[model samples]
Structure formats: C-alpha cells, structure tokens
Target: MNVILIGYMASGKSTIGRVLAEKLNHHFIDLDDYIEKKEQISIGNIFKSKGEIYFRKLEKKYLKAILENENHVVLSLGGGTPCYGDNMNLILNDANSISIYLKTSIAALVSRLKNEKSKRPLIAHIETDDLLAEFIGKHLFERSQYYNLAETKIVTDGKAGTEIVEELMATLL
Candidate 1:
C-alpha cells in the first residue's frame, strides 16, 4: 500500500510522511529530494536553468516512476505536483494508494513560511505583509482545486505534528 500526502508549502507533508512511514514500517520518499538526487541539481537550480516548464515535466516523469513501485511506502509530494499535468489522476488511479491532504489556514501558512522564507524560491521575494498575503492567496487559489481531490483531508491549522499524525493514523487505519 502507498500513503501519499499532498498539501501546500509548510503543511508538514515531509515531516508527517517520515513519522507515518516509520510507524507503518514502510519506505518513505520525498518527491523533491528524489528529484534533486536523480537530476543532480537543486529544484531552485532546475528552475533557474531550465525554467518551470521543464522542471514540471521532470516532476511528472519522476512521479510516474515512483508510482510504479509495488512496495508499501509513504510518499510526500511537492506542493505544486498535483496542480500541473495528470499527476492527481495518476495518484487517484492507484488502487493501493491512499491520498491525504493537509489543510492549513492562510494565516498559519504565512506564519510558518516566515521562518523559512529564504529557502523557498517561490515566496522568497515576498517581503511586505501585503505582498505575502497576495502571494499566498493567489497560489492557494490555484492549488486548492487539485488538493481537494485527495481521498482524505485533515486540517492542520495550529495542530502539533504528532497530533496531526495521530489524526491521520486514525483515519487511515
């Protein structure tokens, strides 16, 4: 079985995926890290060199390859994975996979992102409160439709990591 976690940036997909995989005795894969390792370049660098269109094509190919594995695993997808291509459909078609969406408030996301703004290329340029708000709002609006297609949705606003994990465990089990 494969448990896939999907959500926007700062939604705790990677952290929760690691814990969940450990608990379930399954392999854990973070899609971004996988891409970086396979392509031998940072995602930021990929975007800089080849542009988002090329990076997204690579993301789809990698996602397809990973989905072919039969072993039980927990996969954490990139924030924008489902927003482009047929990635969401590919995930949904996997009978052994269960998709979970971590729903977080814009306020909570903004607060969490502030701490790691330097690391995120997409939001790095967002400086003022107004700009950040607008940036998040626009991106969220674009991504929410894809995120909503997940098999299960859990709100993580203000919740501790373990708390969210527990909720996910309950739902999955």
Candidate 2:
C-alpha cells in the first residue's frame, strides 16, 4: 500500500513519515525532496526562476510517476499538492493508497514556522505573528478542502513524534 501524508507545512509529514516508514519497513519519499533531487535545485530556486505554475506542473508529473511505482512507500506530499491539480483525484483512485492528514492547530503551526521560517521559502517573508497568522489562515482555508479528503486524520497538536506514529499505526493496522 502507498501511504500518502498530506497536511499544512510544519505539520510533521516528512518527519513522521520517515519514522512511520522505518517502523513499517516501507520506502519513504518526500515529494519536495524528490523534486529537488530530480531537478538538482531547491524548491525556492524553482519558484524564484520558473515560477509556481511551472513548479506545480513538475510536481504533478513527479507525483504521477512515483504513484505508479509498485514499491510500498510513505510519500509526504507538498502542502499544496492536492489542492492545485488532479492529484487529489489520482490519489483517491488508487485502491492501495491511504491518505493521512496530519491536522495541527494554527497556533502550533505558527509557532513551529516562526522557528523554522528561514528554511521555508514561502513564508520566509512573514516576520510578525499577525502576518504569519494571516498567511497561514489564507493558505489553510484554501487547502482544507483537499486535506479533508484524506482517508484518516490525525490531530498532531502538542503531540510527540512517537505518540503520533503510534496513533497512525493503530489507525492503519
């Protein structure tokens, strides 16, 4: 089965996916990292040069390719992957695939992002709490529809990695 992790940024999709894959003995693929590896450029650079539309096109292509592979994997998708294209439909059509949404509170997300702002190209310019909240609010509003399509939803608010993983395993098993 292909386990797809979808949620807002800093929701621990990649981190939890890595641990989940290890425990389940499945291959773990972070879609963003996969794209970076394939294109040999950072996502920030992609947005800076080719623009978001181009990056989304590439992301859709990569997602299709990865989903077609037969190997069992835990794929952590980018925040807006399902919201943009036919990606959500493709994921829904796969019988062996299970989508898991890591739901985190806006406050928690803001806190996490504040600390890691420098690493995130999209939100790097957001310097204040008000601006950060506004940015996340808008993005979350736009993406929630796609996120709710997940087969299972896990609330990750104030939870540790092991705790969340255990909950996810229980749900999947």
Candidate 3:
C-alpha cells in the first residue's frame, strides 16, 4: 500500500512521513525531492527557471508515475500538488493508496513558515507577517476543498512530530 501525505505548506508532511515510513517499513518519498532529483534542480529553481506552469506539469507527471509504480511507500506531496490537474482524483482513485491530510491552522502555519520563507517558492516574496498570514488564510481556504477529500485528516497544531506519527500509525491500523 502507498500512504500519501498532503497538506498546506509547512504542515509537517515530510517530517512526519519519514517516521511513519520507518514504522511501517515503507520507503519515504518526498515528491518535491523526487522531482528535484529527476529534474536535477531544486523546486525553487524549477519555479525560477521553468516557471510554475512547467513545475506543476512536472509535479503532475511525477505524481502519477510515483502513485502508479511505487508500493509500501509514504509519499509527501507539494503544497499545491492536489490543487492542480486531476492529481487529487488520481490519488483518491488509487485502490492501494491511503491519503492523509495534515491539517494545520493558518496561525500555526504562519508561525512555522515565517522563518523559512526563503525555502518556499510560493511565499518567499511575502514580506510581512500580516501579509503572510493573509496569504495563508486565503490559500488554505481555497485549497481546503481538495485537501479535505483525503481518506484521513490529522490536526497537527500543538503536536510534536512523534505524536503526529503515533496518531498516523493508529489511524493507519
């Protein structure tokens, strides 16, 4: 089975997925990292060089490839992965996959993301906390529809990585 983790940016998908994969004895694949390795460029660079349209296309292609070919894997998707193309449907339609949304509040996301904006291409230009918060609020509201379709939802606010992992393990069982 493949466990797909989806959520807004800074929602701990990759962090929790690594531990979850260790416990489940599954391979952990961060889709962004997978794309970087395949494209030989950072996701940030991908956006800068090829543009978001191109990046999203690559995301959709690689996402389909991974879902179709991988097994016993914990895959963490990019923030906008499900919002583009038919990616959510592809994930939902897969019989061997379990989709989990690591839901995080906008305030929590703002706090977590403020320090790491440079690492994220989408919000790197957001200069102020108020603007960052506003962006997150609007973006989360927009993306919630796609994210909520996940087979499982786990709230990650005020939770440690291990606690989230434990909750995911229990949910998986």
Question: Relative to the true structure, how large is the alpha-carbon lDDT of every model?
Answer: 0.91, 0.93, 0.96
Ranking by lDDT: 3, 2, 1
- Location of the lowest summed lDDT over 10 successive residues in candidate 2: 63-72
- The residue-level lDDT of candidate 3 at 146 comes to 100
The TM-score ranking, best first, is: 3, 2, 1
Per-residue lDDT tens digits for candidate 3, residues 1-173, read 99999999899999999999999999999999999999999999999998999999999999999988999999999999999989999999999999999999999999999999999999999999999999999999999999999999999999999999999999998
Which candidate comes out best when scored by lDDT?
A: 3
Error of 2 at 7 (Å): 0.1
Compare the candidates by TM-score and give the number of the best one. Answer: 3
Query: Please, what are the lDDT tens digits per residue for candidate 2 over residues 7-78?
Result: 999999999999999998999999999999999999999999999999999999999999897468999999
* Candidate 1 ranges with C-alpha deviation above 4 Å: none
lDDT at 32, model 1: 95
RMSD of every candidate to native, in Å, equals 1.0, 0.9, 0.6
lDDT of 1: 0.91
TM-score of each: 0.96, 0.97, 0.98
Model 3 RMSD vs true structure: 0.6
